[model samples]
Target chain A: MAAIQGEVSWFCCGTAWGPCGTAGGGACGTCKSGNYQHAWPNTSDACYAITHPDTCGLSMSRRGCGFRHYTTNLCNGARVGTTIADCGPQTDLFCGERTCCGSACGSNRIIDLTPAAFSAIGSLSVGLRPCSVDTV
Target chain B: MPQTLDRRRLLATAALGGVVGATGLGSLAPDAAFAAEAAAIEPGAPDPNFVEGRISKISGHLLLVLGSDTVLHSIRITDGTSIWKLHPTTFDQVAIGDGLYARGVRLPDGTLAADSVWVNIVNLHAHIAAVGRNLLHLDHKGQRIVAHVVQGRSAAVYNGTPAVSDLSLLRVGRHVQVLGAWHPDTNEIDIATVYAAA
Candidate 1:
């Protein structure tokens, strides 16, 4: 699949504590805060209805649970591979949101990685980073 | 530049050794080690090795923290520990009452041997409601925030480009993710990096 450019953020899932305690096992019922996992906005019709990437004038492919995608942190050139474990990012809420590293910039929030996957490519403290998502 | 390089080298060496503050064989990167440690915790559970809270006390290299959930944590800082306040700093710069997020190894005694700690760091997603000289009015989650741009320190990254100090490209109505230092108990923040589209 062609690469999708957008903002990437993180969420804690699985059995979690504190504010993350309510995240549960995600939409796939298999998410873990420590796993290399991610949430795709269009995991299902219900998921797509909520995320609504099209409302932001972006077309995103519908990928299902366990589908693999690679996310690159534009700031540092760091990358990680992860599987879909949930549906998320409520994309319509933050339409027109954009982030960039240099010449590479992504518009809108497209993907949310698990904490373990996110911290691998970027600092959790930063919360969000410009990213490119590819199927390679 | 040499000093920065040396510090990075030291950190790399420490990470490669997989001994942040205790003896262990793990990944060759500090983040990798942290990921490995996190995996050991039960799924959907609070990470045992990751602690987030405010520093209530600091004695020597140890930090006494009161978690947001009311849990108490003892975090031990080591030479290998990388600290970031606004920028990369030393342990001494970590002051009391600063909020922090630490990732490391949880020792058998329940103390966390921190590999990395971020103090007063906040990453916010907001829209540019207005722009003024050296400042931006942000609307975050329906709340207004005053974000100040620290000259020379604040940078902007446009369209996946390298960061630059010029922020004139920021436009009202555009959404942005800001990484900066938060003033305790305030809606104000000092911008470190602003990521947005041109």
Candidate 2:
């Protein structure tokens, strides 16, 4: 994989806030909102069954817990390094949805960062941004 | 299982050079190589499940916040909502000016019914400009940031190694990534982990 391009969003975990209360620190049980972490669609079989990025024409490798990946915000040229903390993005639900920055754009939600990781590159309120993910 | 895990780690580490080198863009900085791999997707589709910003006001259980992009959001909290400041804390620990990232259901009335909120958490890439007794002077994108190392809490990962609580290996002027809790409206952070090249 040269670099996987896709839409990036943020998620909450590790006993903070509501709705996220039951997120249960992700599938890895090591996810913390204060940590540099992200949710990859293909952490495990059960995770793949839930996110299914393949349904959206995106093929992600099974990078399990603590696997390192660098995510760059195409819009601002900002990048952050994070470890796989859980499984996520529910790719099929937002199949055709796109996120862009300047002339750079990525389609289909393939990655979700923790608040700490996402804010390091771009503002979280933007919700979705075009990004590239690569193992570092 | 251990052998399988070891193989995966080897592959992942090798991929760092293998796939990245295959791009024919070896001269590029690691960050630049990552950027060059950019591909565009569908644009302007908002994420309906999340919100981020600073708490401008606390009205009962509702929090009025101003997003980093200047958008205003009204977030509703309940007993079920989990709030974290430095750790797993209660809503009473929240204060005005505290930065928050919330994930939950968006109400028809345009409010976000938050289920979880993290306060003042930050991930930063910086150069270790200097080191003091228990502090790391970091240079983040040309800006200086002070990071405090907490005993029993602060950890470091050398190269791609597992994390350990030892700052003795950190050298000055090395590029590192820091994950920590922000002190809110300041240039300081409480370090949780520092990732560095061995």
Candidate 3:
């Protein structure tokens, strides 16, 4: 069996009917199909779009327009509306041009040149290349 | 499905599946010096069940619509999905060249919401359709469409931010956009994402 890395559980709660903690390492509160949250709170707010404005992590907005903040986006268009704007300011130390790949595909290691909309936890991820960029 | 140009969008997407890391929007700014026209094209309005299209023809109540693959489908019109059935009255009065919107279900017989029908013919895409008070209307690919008019003062609706500014410029015959849901039981479509394009 392919052992998952530390504290990774696709099963919403990591445990049955329980809140995930460091054991499950889940940020979501509720783990149901229609329920999307981290550490279920008492707020009545509905599930914010996964590509919500707050999820941008940068100035980018999830308006789904070609809004590029960090110059990267999510895997599929599902997360397309997110922004990677914050990733740019931190690019100076990584590479003159975010050429460092975090995980995902081992192909190349570098932050995408163009802005994208993916969720970043700690480090910047690399792999996305626009259709036609002079660098790519 | 609309074909993707498949460049940056694809690469970014590729990175996502391999790892959960998404780049912050700021880092890519440096490359913006040379990045092509990646203005982050907004997606069409949120589509529930994804059923709505531009109109092509209208001869009286028998309107010809550009459906999947741009095939002209002879559409019969109706209106509203009220439980008390009060919405039905407005729907039956539909006319030609109206930039109409609808929602229904695909039945086993290959017909859509055939047994029942529900719709809202007030007005759609009126800003982009270049319609007059005679009922919203516009022409697309040699097809004419009349839409419902949803007139109101330019309100600050959520687009991307609270600073995105006023949207009072929306007009008819100007490539409008809308997002919302559809119901098969009443065969009705409710507008949600409604915006006019240049």
Candidate 4:
């Protein structure tokens, strides 16, 4: 699959306490804050209908549960491999938003990762980072 | 060296033995940690071991927090806990009304035994509306934000490159992400790192 460029952020999901307790199992019903998992905008028709990446001039392919993708943090060279485990990011809300590192830049929000996966490649406190998503 | 070994032993005990006394490690049980590691975990659930809120009161090593959701929390700090306020700091620097995010092991008594705490940290995604000497005017989610570049501490990372002190690559009208320490109750932040395209 071709590489997709965009911003990546982290979210927590699991049997948790506090405000995160209501997030449940996400769209795929299998995400965990401790696992190497991520949320893709186009996991299904229903998911795509909500995220609407096309509104931002990007055409994202549809991939379903458990598909693996490697994400690289553009701010640093850090990378992590994660499997699709949810639907999210609500891309249309931040249309035209862009981030870049040197010559590599991506527009809009495209992916969200579980805390364990994100903290592996980037600091959880940093929140958002430009990223490249690939399947190799 | 002995202190380090004792800390390690306490952490191991917290992981395996399910309970540890309130000594140098605070009161932490293994149930929250084990639940996080369980395979039948649900995504989007609240993390039992993580809490975010504003400090409403502080009593010795115990901090009383009021979460954004109006939930009350008790967080216990220990010698092993790492604290960051703008930069790394000691527990005494943590003040009332400061926003914080804590990750730790939740004890059976519901007090969080914090392993780390970040005070007043913010990660913002914004457009560089303008730039001035030692400052950047940001448009974040339709709100104006003023980000100050500390002479010695501010840095920039461009195009997957290593961070450097030079921030000349930041361009007006371009989108950038900023990691900084926010000034609570204000529209300002102190820039730590700005990630931009050159």
Candidate 5:
């Protein structure tokens, strides 16, 4: 599939530090802060209801558990390959908000990675970054 | 369409299995790169149980957020809520402007009674412009970003391999993707993982 452009962020699960404790293993029951995993907006129909990428005019496919997605930070061309550990980054909530670096700007939060996965491509403190998601 | 892909995957998996069985490598390595793309869900669909945004206001245990799409979210934190900001923290650690991703139940009032909240996290791709002592100069599009290497915290992956602590494999002019913590209002970031083609 072609690359899908959007915003990317991080989430925590498994045995982790601080507030991360509240996060259990994600919807997949396999997520952890240390795994190379991510949360995809379209994993199932129930997940679609919450993320509602349609509300924001974005079309995402319904990939199931263990699906792999390569998320590339548009700003730096840095990329990370992660498996789907949970469902996430509800798209409709922040439909029009934009995050930019240099001349690259992307709107909508489409994915959320675990700490281990997130820290692999970008910083966690920055909160969000414009990214493009692809299959390989 | 997914069924078609599944059939393809099954054939690939079978071929890989045969190869692994013959070589006694104890693993099946098919066209993993291609498989990665094939496993994606239908477009526009997302996981329903999660929310992402920034803190706009806080009232008691309820944290008000403005989503990346400019939607407002009122997330409630119970004693069961786990909040993370760089590290495991408490509700007091959360502040306005802090970006968050909360996973929990969506209540009838539209508030998400969160179970876990991770604040200020980012994942991006960049080109390694230069490397220094504990520092990597990166180019993200037309922008220059300085990423600091934290010992024991930073790792690298070469050619879709497992992550390792040795970052010596990093080279100048190589395109790499980074995952780390963003230092608000700066071009600096903390390096977590650097993926490069070995």
Candidate 6:
């Protein structure tokens, strides 16, 4: 705790902080004392600012065409954790209780593309003939 | 001392397959054909020692079979035989449902040290009970039989429709005719064909 001013790494940085190296391979001279190298994942539409602001909003809407009956829940449940449905009841090609968002034909179920209407999301693939359906 | 005695008898059983010591001493699938095959395997032939058997259970490829006198014989098709003229690859080609036949040498412990094992080698008209992986578990009238496809051996579709190069046609739920070899040690029948039939 002496009176050494310009001798420490922090003391040197206390001035105009040195250029910070971005996690991306390029270097940024505007770095401050506490700055560290980090890179943007480049997945979203916007580059992450120094404050890590989320420029890309949520893809799925809460009440719009993006939300379907049990479709999102099924996929999310399948990818995230254990699913309680017997996938056969859905179809042979897929696993779970919910069918794809589509239309229904004889010897087949419904097939529709309500989710694909979202501008940011990709269109759903063509639905197939389900092998099993609950007979009512 | 029975283990030692069994080993001694087993070593004696390796005498060129000519030991004819006992008629029904060993073998899992106890069929009259096995006696003929054993006799056929005795004399000079190209790899006559090879055969098939059923897995009483599996701990890896090492299967325990109720072989020959209902003895739980430990068997493994390690380093199986193949005919490069017939099959290009042998890895993961074998299963329990497909018929198979192997012609090779026998070891002292009553195991088939096959130099060449053929899948779907023998043919039979049998009823299918269950199907799992290369194993077509079947019941021939009153007998419990196993039709297996060896790793390298190919199978013939239908009963007389030449041989099929692909194994995708084999299914587990269909009753059919199979042609192949029987290995007593492993208690597996090497399958050549599987479908709707006897």
Identify the superior model by lDDT, candidate 1 or candidate 2. 1
Q: Write candidate 3's Cα lDDT for B73-146 as tens digits.
A: 55433221111111323433443333323322233333222112222221121234453442334442243443
Q: Higher-lDDT candidate among 4 and 5? A: 4
In model 6, where do residues sit more than 4 Å from their true spots? A1-136, B1-52, B57-63, B76-80, B83-102, B118-122, B126-198
Using TM-score as the measure, what is the rank order of every candidate, best first?
A: 1, 4, 2, 5, 3, 6
User: Which residue segments of model 2 deviate by more than 4 Å?
Assistant: A1-136, B1-44
Off by over 4 Å in 1: A1-7, A11-39, A43-51, A54-109, A114-117, A125-136, B1-43
| TM match of model 1 to true structure | 0.67
The per-residue C-alpha lDDT of model 4 at residue B163 equals 78
Per-residue lDDT over B3-116 for candidate 6, one digit per residue giving the tens place of the 0 to 100 score: 322432343343334343332333322111121221211111112232333334546544454421233444444432232112323536555433233333356566553333
lDDT of 2 by residue, A14-111 (tens): 65432233455778888876467888889999989978888888878888888888888887677777888888867765566655555788877778
Top-scoring candidate (lDDT): 1
Please tell me which model should have the higher TM-score, number 4 or number 6.
4
For candidate 3, give the lDDT of residue B151: 32
Every model's TM-score? 0.67, 0.50, 0.24, 0.63, 0.46, 0.23
**Candidate 4 lDDT over residue span A78-136, tens digit each:** 66777888897777656766666566576778898876666545555555678889986
Task: Give the per-residue lDDT of model 1 (tens digit) for A30-84.
Answer: 8876567889999999999988999989899998998988887776666778889
Q: Worst ten-residue run, lDDT, model 5 chain A?
A: A14-23
Interface RMSD of each: 6.5, 16.7, 20.7, 9.4, 14.4, 33.0
What is the RMSD of candidate 4?
8.5
Q: Model 6, A53: alpha-carbon shift in Å?
A: 90
Give each model's whole-structure lDDT.
0.73, 0.68, 0.25, 0.71, 0.66, 0.29
Residue ranges of candidate 3 with Cα displaced over 4 Å: A1-136, B1-63, B74-89, B92-95, B98-101, B114-153, B158-198
RMSD per model, one decimal: 6.9, 19.5, 22.6, 8.5, 17.2, 28.4
- DockQ, ranked from best to worst: 1, 4, 5, 2, 3, 6
Candidate 2, chain A: TM-score against the reference: 0.95
Chain B TM-score in candidate 1, rounded to 2 decimals? 0.80
Scoring only the A-chain of each prediction against the true A-chain gives TM-scores of 0.96, 0.95, 0.19, 0.95, 0.96, 0.15
Error of 5 at B111 (Å): 0.7
